[model samples]
Target chain A: MDTRILLGAFIVYSLSTFFYLLNLTSERKNSYGRIAHFLLLSAFIIHIMSVVARYFIAGYTPITNSHEALSFFSLCIAGFFLYVKKIYKVEILGAVILPVVLVILIFATAMPSDIRPLPPVLNSYWLPIHTIFSFIGNAIFLVSFFISITYLIVEKGLKEKRFSFSIMRFPSLEVLDSINYRCMSYGFIFLTIGIITGSIWASNAWGAYWSWDPKETWSLITWIIYAVLIHNRMAIGWRGRKTAYMMILGFFSMLVMFFGVNFLLGGLHSYM
Target chain B: MSDIQLLAFGFNHTTAPVEVREKLYVSEEEIPSFLQELKDTCIRELVFLYTCNRMEVYICADDREKAMESLYRVFCNRFKIRPEYLSNYTYTLEDKEVFRHLFLVASGLDSMVIGEPQILGQVKDAYRIATTFNCTGFYLDKIFHKTFNVAKRIRTETKIGYNPVSISSMAVELSKKIFGDLKRKKILVIGAGEMCEIALRHFQKEGIADISVTNRTFANAKRLAEEIIGTPYPFEDIPLLLTEVDMVLSSTGASRPIIDKPLITTVMKKRKNKPLFLIDIAVPRDIEPDVNNIENVYLYDIDDLKDLSQKHLSDRMKEAEKAKKIIEEEVEKLSRAINQVDVAPLISHIVEKFEATRENELKKYIVKLKNVDDDTLKTIDILTRGIVNKLIHPYIAMIKENGNPAVLETMKKIFRFGEDDEEKLDNRKQGE
Candidate 1:
């Protein structure tokens, strides 16, 4: 039943993506964005219900496998996207971000979602705390990645004086840039907490406070990139196209940390 | 026959020069008495659509030639123009052409700038004024009401009036795209000339509150600032103002470029790289073209703005074709409606056919009767008359209510009204 409900969420997200695409392509201004927004809100609610049901079935937080982690990642993205939408009039941004979420959900559904015994290495309170914080941080950066690309497209159009219909309803360069900044600050805080909680969990599981695992090393690199972005933006006035480029770079680094280390490197965090 | 002729006469931008139109233009204050004078001349239902581009008078009158002559005399006497010269500049349309012309005008298809929206509002005001003066009757009222509907229909069905094409409005649109809300945004106006003042007013309408005016001459800046309730800055304060304002609009008569790359580069550093929008409408280009290459700076010279405007104008032109097609369809529908109004022949033909049938059938029944009495014959005649009138009443009501053309044609066919008779009805309806 939980898997069925999750499938229901995937379908709703697809419907929401269809409406956002329609809102983007059409020139006439109407309520397509508003309809897409409502659809996304309902999809998020159904997604939360599925996750809660999964917890009741498994008797633990569902972050121990690739299926659970990817599902949780997509859920965090949808949640953060909704929060960003409430703060900004970036309805067109959904056209780009919702497809990414849908793709992640597809990969998640492809993986095994059966109830399994919890591995001894993952049985701790830090399992949920570390994974939840890290997924939310990655989700925030994911939204910023699309926003950065939108900022670049609009900024280029303005510089070239080529006003096309695709980017016609996009938020301004300032608005996109400001959203990137907000994401950078909040994502950095969540990432710091995730890293700290992981190290403390490492002390309990592996009997060490610090270990140079591939995921840890890559996360450090991602953290450094965003730290530089925040510092330069506040102190040296790095903004507009420059800030958009940095956000794209930081998001790529985060991808390597979240997926590459687990899938290829076979680190201690390989359960995810 | 209704005997009411629809007439339209006007001086428009196409037919008359600006000087001639200005001379003949009637202000709103003068319209009531002008209408009364036409009323005294035996012209009843009329609406005077007065706008800067065109001044057309639509009238429903009993005498076409006399109405035209009276209108010319009113133009000559009211504006002190000679009759021959006025006749040379004005064009007149009648009946079907008048309906088509008013639809085109109301829908902005006939505007000087095709698909411009203000003409619709002006047309509405004209109809409202005529109604207030108690001038419009059923015919005029019906046409004007349909005119408004046509205008609204065209607006929704096409993208003709979607984008802003004028230079000042395009600037405001771009500003909104850059800054989501213009409220509390500061604008620095260079030169304080008429062009700058007009563009500034456009921005002000968008809620840009903090406006600073600067010019080469301090007094001119002060005067313009006072006029618009803005702060005046000196010419030497250009760099200082650059760091403070979000947008800069420059239009001056200087031969060389005024604001350049290095000045803005230093200003951007001082302002910590806040985004700056610069519009240079000057001939020699008040801002250097190279300044656009700078980071966090967006510069659009006059040529770029004009190019965007030209694109929008072409978009409107493409949509105008669609709008014209809609108007043609509406005109055809309205033509059918007017023809239905003049369906007196059809009504009479149906009654005569039924009467002949009733008389023939009654004669046959009477011949079969043995020793028929006068009272019995009267009762039979009354019964046949009652049946004929009752059968025809609903069909007559449907035709009078302007039934759909297909249904009306089916009724005509059921009555055996021939194709030749239909041609005669149309000919008489067209008054041709």
Candidate 2:
């Protein structure tokens, strides 16, 4: 039943993605954006239901396996994107973002989705708290990653004075930069808490608080890079193209920490 | 039907020099009187558009020869210009040519800068003024309204006015991209030259509240500062002032670079790396090129700005082709509508002529049949009317459905109504 609900969410997400792409390409004034926004809201509700159902069936947090982890991450991204859309006129960003979410959901569906028993080590309340915070932080940064790319394209075109209709549709440089800043600020707070809660969870699961595991070490590196970025942005006045470049760099490091640490180097957090 | 001839008379930037255009320009205050003078003559429907680049008058007249003569006389009397001299610089377009030219002007295709948006507003103002003076009737009103619609359609359907093409506007556009809002931003002007003043005025219009001016001569700086309501500083305080302002516009008559990389590096440190935008429009270069490499510093020199403007101009040129095609398509559609309107009166005249001929012949035959009863006479009248309508049904239908010019001419010839009838209709409308 949870799988059926997840499939319904995926279908709605696809429809929303189609509309967003249409909104981007269409020159005529239309309500495609409002329609897409409605669909995304509905998909978010159904997606939350699926996660709740999974939790009830599994008798623990649903982020234990690759399928559950990716699905939840994509859900967090959709949630954050909807939140950003409320504040900024960023309907155009959906044309790029919704497709990415759709692809991630596809990967999540392809993975083994069978409910499995929780391992002996991750059988605690810290599972949800630690994983949810970390996933939320990663989701916000993922959105900022795409925002950074858009910022670069727009900034380059304006700096070079080469204008195109396609580039003109993207949010302006200032709007994009502000969104990036807002994302990074919230993302940094969540990341810091996630790391602190992770260490506390480690103490509860294992004997020590600091294990220096491969995932732990990599998450530290990601945290330090973002720390430097935030510091530079607030203190050194790093903005526009420079901030965009830094955000992209931090996202790449985050990719290595999230994916590379799990598959390439087995770690304490590689139960999936 | 009214026999109002559509006429457009004007000279634009390409046809007349500035001196000639200025002499012919009618200010807004003078427009009502000028239009009143024309109304005193023979013109009943007219609109005058007077801009820096063009002087135009659109007319819907009953007598073209009389309207032209009156227009020439008014120009000669109002501006102290001779009639023969005015004719050399002016152009007169009638019918279809007038419609096409008006469409081009309203859509900004005939502008000095192709696809400019300001000319459309000016055209609207002209129409509004004409309406206030009660100078426009059915014909001019319909054409002007259609022109506005076509202009709007072209704006949405084409990218002709997408980017800023002028140098000052380009600088302003780049600053917006970097800084977002210029309302609270502070700017420092390096020189008091014409380029600096023009660009500064553009910036001032954007609401840059804190402006500082500096030049080699303190008096020149003070004079420029007083004119534009900015604070003037000595030239030696350039590095000191750079830290306080968000943007710097430098266009001096310097032989060497005035501001260099090292100076900006120190200034950025002092300002803690707040973003700085620099526009250097000097010929010999005001700021060094390497200053652009510093983080959070954007520098655009004269050549860079020119390249952008050149590219945008070319882009507009390409988009103008698309806009012109759209205009031509609309012109064709509207021309067809106008022709349909023209043939409405002709169609009614044909039907009326057939009915009149049928009644006259019926009367002549009825007088000869004195033995017929009243009921028989009524039946005969009905029979003759039905036979005439059925016989002429195909011809009337052909003329109404297919507004073909040759068909119209043939129908007129068959009825023995030729150019003389058209002249009579014109004369009758004049009487009305």
Candidate 3:
């Protein structure tokens, strides 16, 4: 039943993604955008229900497996997107980000979703806090990555003195850049806390605070990239195309940290 | 009533030069007397829109030729222009053409700048003033309301107003692209030239109040600064001000480059590589071309602004076609609404005629049944009225669906509802 609810949420997300894409090509009328926002909100609510149901059924945190973790990650991204859209009035961002959420949800569906008893090493009080903060942080980074991509496209269009449909749909580069900076800063702080909590959990479970685990190394690398971006933006006032490139790179490293570490590196964190 | 006609008469930028339009321009204070004079001349409903680029009067009048003659005399007397000169510039439209023309005007499609937004507001103001003076009757009120709706629809449904086309506006747009918000951004005007002042005014409209003015002559800078409510800085302070300001608008009378690469590079260092937007609108260029090569300086000369403005203008022109389509659709809708209104009186007339005949027949029968009680008579009256209403329902539906003038006329003639009765109905409807 929880899986069915998750599937329903996935369908709604795909619809929202399609509507947002349709809105970009539509005439200046905002009905398509309004519909997309409504669908996204519905999807987010259903996703929450599914997560809650999974938690109730499993009698522990639902993010004990790759399937649940990836689903939760997509849910956090959609939730953050709705929050930012409410504050920033950047509906156009959904046109770029909803597809990314849909892809993550699709990848989650591809993984095994069967409820499994927690592995002996996975049972812990710190699981919820560590995983929730990390997923939320990763979700925020995903938004920044999408916004940075939009910024680069719009900036390139302006520089080349060309106007395309996608460029016209983008928010101004200044708005995109400011939102990118905000997302990066918030993402960095949360990721820092997430890593610290994870290390604390590691020490309690494995008698070490620091581990050379592949996920840990990649997460650190991702955190450093965003740290540089934030520092450069605030202290040195670095912005525009260079910052956009950094955000894209940071998001890639985060992807490697989440997926590559699990599938290829096979470290102490491989169970996730 | 037969003579009443919708008429739109105007001399716009296409038909008249600035000199002619200036002569015919009526100030706001003069509107009451002008509307009174127009009313006295048999213009039953009227609105006059006076903008810098166009002077127009839309009217519903009883005698078209006499109304035009009186309007011509008013124009000749008020502006002191000769009748022949006025006639050469004046163009007139009638009936459906009047509606089409007014819709085009209200939607900014008839603007000199092509999709400029000011004309719609001017048109609305004219309608409001006419309404205040009791010069706008039912037809004018209905059409003006429809016109405003059409304008709003065009504005929302098309990209006509999406881009800025003027050079100064384009400069402001470029600054927004760089700075995001101009509210707290400082602007430095490098010269007291008209173009520089114009660009500053554009920035002022964006709520940027921190403006510093400097010129080759300190006195000129001070005067311009006082005029624009900005602080006047010394010409020698350009380097220091350059590091502080987010944008510099330069349009000096210099024959060669006044700001060069080395100078801005030093300023960039002082400002720690922050973005600087330099708009050099001078002929020989106040800022050197190579200054754009500096780390964070974006330089755009007059040609670049003009190019951007031209591109935007063409884009608006393309959007204008879409706007025209919207206007066309709205015009059709409005015409259908008008026809629906026209059918209302016809339906009422048919019902009234049938009831009158029914009353007459009932009166004739009352004498034959002299002993009939009041209650029975009331029931009989209700029954006859219901029958008449049921008999007219199909005809009313038919008339509403196919409001063909010839068929309506034939129906009215057959029922002895003459044109005079139609006029009375119209007057009664207007009174209500």
Candidate 4:
């Protein structure tokens, strides 16, 4: 995928987030909504093509070799969220999270277009599988992002005596919580697979199955947050604002693994 | 005023215990028979809404006194409650009063919880059951449909169900009552339906985190399973899931009893009889009727929704009343407009005739002799038409006054009622 095309898709998604957020007080019209859905579909397809084009240029999948995979995962997260929001008729949900997706994709586009292939140790079938699952896992955390936004706004609306017209466009609190669990549950599974695949590839490359690397530790931390959320939801009846808050905090750990681990903390997962 | 008849009766948490509510439940099985009893009433439109909190029957009749007597006696006979229990609690709404009551009830104003949305669904279900028995008539159908639409308008235009604790949120409250602390419990959902998702989501939010899922299909079950990190087991895995899980919510669409007698009994023996709260939300019933017999087994079928709905209503009384007022005001405005539509056309016609004559006089002077061409003659005709409108506009407007008080009163009443007949009559008179 051309970095420019991927950048363009990010811009389109970012604008949609703006338009949908502007729609909060504005009258909701199906005509514009239908247009919004088509635009997002177009953007998702374009985004996929961008990733494919980049792979063709890179000679091997861009999923390996660190920097590209992390950036690609964020765009994947945006595309998945936009698709899910449209399916459920909760398009406003995209308004809260797509901005983050746009920023991550923009950052990915700003990096060097390409030059290096994976090290002889980096080439493996598990690398692509691991990357795909890990991206999918992070996409679920994005869903939690949207739901937490809705829970807060709805609470404020109800508490004030006047229901915000913008809140009307959002899903019910029950539906919001449901979406969060759905995201966290899927994200958990994907992360588990990601860890397993990373371990297997690491052993193949360096003769070890387990290493307490920064990226690995951070991924584990993300996994624990989701585990607590699921446990709270099933056993203790922990949901609503508290669960939403935890989901967000967990996503932050994921954020650290992405940007902070690479540029700020400079871990093995980081690339020059 | 004709001898219009009205009867308003309901059984809610305020009036009836859960045992009595279960007895008078008028289940999906009983709805068919209840409508059969109402078939012979002189009532034009009949609505039967049964919830754990209340069973309300609103009948529209010209002879309000007789209709109330007949409807009240049926309730007295069915529940075996005495007449003393009837007049004191039962409310009667005849003619216009019936219209207001239906609107109020549909809007959730008359409910103990004033703004709850469940009554609309319950009312729809009751109407559907009545239709199955071929009991609802023209008047009831129109009125109830109108009532529902008005309720919809109030919901959309205002914030009726937005405040206080909602019924779904309170479902968690019921869970807390059973388990004391939610964090220690495990929830197993039997199906992948919306309610199961909602209940699972709620339990997840509450902090009771261990969860398992057993659905009809393994793939959907696995998918939801992968997301939640719960074991996605097959249907045969249910008995095992139930014993280990503290709460089980079954919302599957099964033809016969899916959770039959032998399955629940064997399952209960596994966990030394841990408190099993089973919410059977399915219509045909996913759990066996005999499942209720097991010790420490609290089985709540759809009948319990009415009570749950009632508890929510009491918690939301103020909002319900506000929503009801909005619906009633809307109905009143509609009735007044319906009344005017009948009389307005009669006034429009007499004015049209006066305008036509004035045009002829003005055109004779615009000179029929002027260019003797089609284009020139058309322009002259338009000029004369304007003159006619200016000349006859006042006289036509005064016909609505008609110099008669009786005519005015009749039109006022017709518009107040918003009957379709009056509008048709004006259309007929205008045609002639």
TM-score, prediction 2: 0.89
Number of colliding residue pairs in each model: 0, 0, 0, 50
For residues B1-432, what per-residue lDDT tens digits would candidate 2 score against the true structure? 135568899799988888898788777688899888877456879999888999899998878899998888888999899888898899999877787898899888999888888899999999999999899988788788989999999888887887788889888877876776789899999999888889888998898878999999999999999989999999999989999998999989999999999999999888877778899999999899989888678789989888878888888899989988988898777777777787777777777677767766777777799898989988998998899899888988887676556777787778655457676556444433
Query: Per-residue lDDT tens digits of candidate 1, residues A1-111?
Result: 889999999999999999999988765554688889999999999999999999999988998889998999999999999999889878888899999999999999999
* Model 4: fnat (fraction of native contacts): 0.00
Give me the candidate number with maximum lDDT.
Answer: 1
Query: Lowest summed-lDDT stretch of 10 residues in model 1 chain B?
Result: B423-432
Give me the displacement of residue A58 in model 3, in angstroms: 1.5
Task: Report the error of model 2 at residue A170, Å.
Answer: 3.6
Report chain A TM-scores, every model: 0.97, 0.98, 0.97, 0.89
Q: Per-residue lDDT tens digits of candidate 3, residues B310-428?
A: 88788889988988788778777776676677667667877877776776787778789978899999999899888988998888887777745677666666665646766656644
* Structural similarity to truth (TM-score) of each candidate: 0.89, 0.89, 0.86, 0.48
What range of 10 consecutive residues in model 2 chain A has the weakest lDDT sum? A159-168
Candidate 3 residue A97 Cα shift, in angstroms, is 1.6
Error of 1 at B109 (Å): 2.2
Pairs clashing within candidate 3: none
Regions of model 2 farther than 4 Å from truth:
A22-35, A56-59, A158-167, A235-242, B356-432
